[model samples]
Target: MAMSRNEILDQVKEVLVDALGLDEDEVTEGATLMGDLGAESIDFLDIVFRLEKTFGIKVPREELFPAESLMNNPDFVSGGKLTPKGLAEFKARMPHSDFSKFEANPDINKLTDLFTVAAVVNFVERKLNQAA
Candidate 1:
């Protein structure tokens, strides 16, 4: 059976709390990842790695760090800042055609509650598949 939205969110929160060393209560859906979570670029990459390990997904380097044009999108954001809600919304909006097949698939439509763990895992898994 597929995981429930709450289940995914809870897992995402747990991953963030453990990986980023933040208190569980601090990681709300609207919290800013960089501003609130104190995650630098390297830390973000580490989170990506942890996600991949947890969910067996791969994300592309280009996708992970897209060009400025792609960066301009609200979904992509400025200053490496991402709100948990925004991240969830972006995942929900991604089309199947936008990503390569073979990575671990999570319920992006339910992503508003999905959080970063599943998304990061899906991204890293996609990258790994591309490299294979």
Candidate 2:
């Protein structure tokens, strides 16, 4: 048996609420982990650990958050914004994220927007399906 999307989202919310010290209502599908929920880099580790423990799935840090690598590459990033190549790589790497708004400005600071609660749910759902 597989968990439904809502179930996955509920678990993700729990993870975020505990890991980020957030109220349940703050962890909405559209909530950006960093921007909206105030999740620092360290919180991500706790979130991943909790998600893995809760779901019994391996959660790779880079697999879920590939921004660090992409941001450092000159070809991918220049002038504090993502180059076209960077955008392409981001799209490939962050398939779970919504790129519509980011594609417009492509500002490096906006990279945090890519890490939404829904994206976490999507990644967990994909990982669980793969395990199944």
Candidate 3:
């Protein structure tokens, strides 16, 4: 009884559209939640909550956004920018996110901006797989 990728994306779209007051068209897989979709930091919490409710899965905040963990790791950050190792780790952690722009500059403060609609789909899939 696992959900297909499209099913997950559709549910994710519903949550994002309702939570952020976004149009269905704007919540595409490549759409960055913060930069492209106008999602603020507070909206992140709402998104997570709605995803958990819709999917019946417990997604810890850190799992969706690991800024706190990254900041605390010296090897991951230095002088407010991501180290080479940090960039690799970030890519590994968030494979679903589009890192094209973020990789160019790698600003720690703007890390959340890397989150795309596809990332939510990946997260939900991982959580569901884990539960199974």
Best by TM-score: 2
Q: Give me the displacement of residue 74 in model 2, in angstroms.
A: 0.5
Better of 1 and 3 by TM-score: 3
Of candidate 3, the 10-residue stretch with the lowest lDDT total is 92-101
User: Which runs in model 1 stand beyond 4 Å of their true positions?
Assistant: 61-132
Residue 119 Cα positional deviation in candidate 3, in Å, after optimal superposition: 0.6
TM-score of each candidate structure, all chains considered together: 0.51, 0.97, 0.85
Q: How accurate is candidate 2 locally (lDDT)?
A: 0.92
Candidate 2, residues 13-126, lDDT tens digits: the string is: 988988988889888899999999998889988988999999999999999999987788999999999999989999999888999998999999999999999999999999
lDDT of 1 at 96: 19
30, model 2: CA deviation in Å? 0.5
Off by over 4 Å in 2: none
* Cα misplacement distance, residue 93 of candidate 1 (Å): 8.8
| lDDT, candidate 3, 1-132, per-residue tens | 989999999999999999999889989898888889998879999999999999999989887887677788999999999999999998887766778888889989778777888888999988998998
lDDT of 1: 0.51
Q: How many clashing residue pairs appear in each of the predictions shown?
A: 11, 0, 0
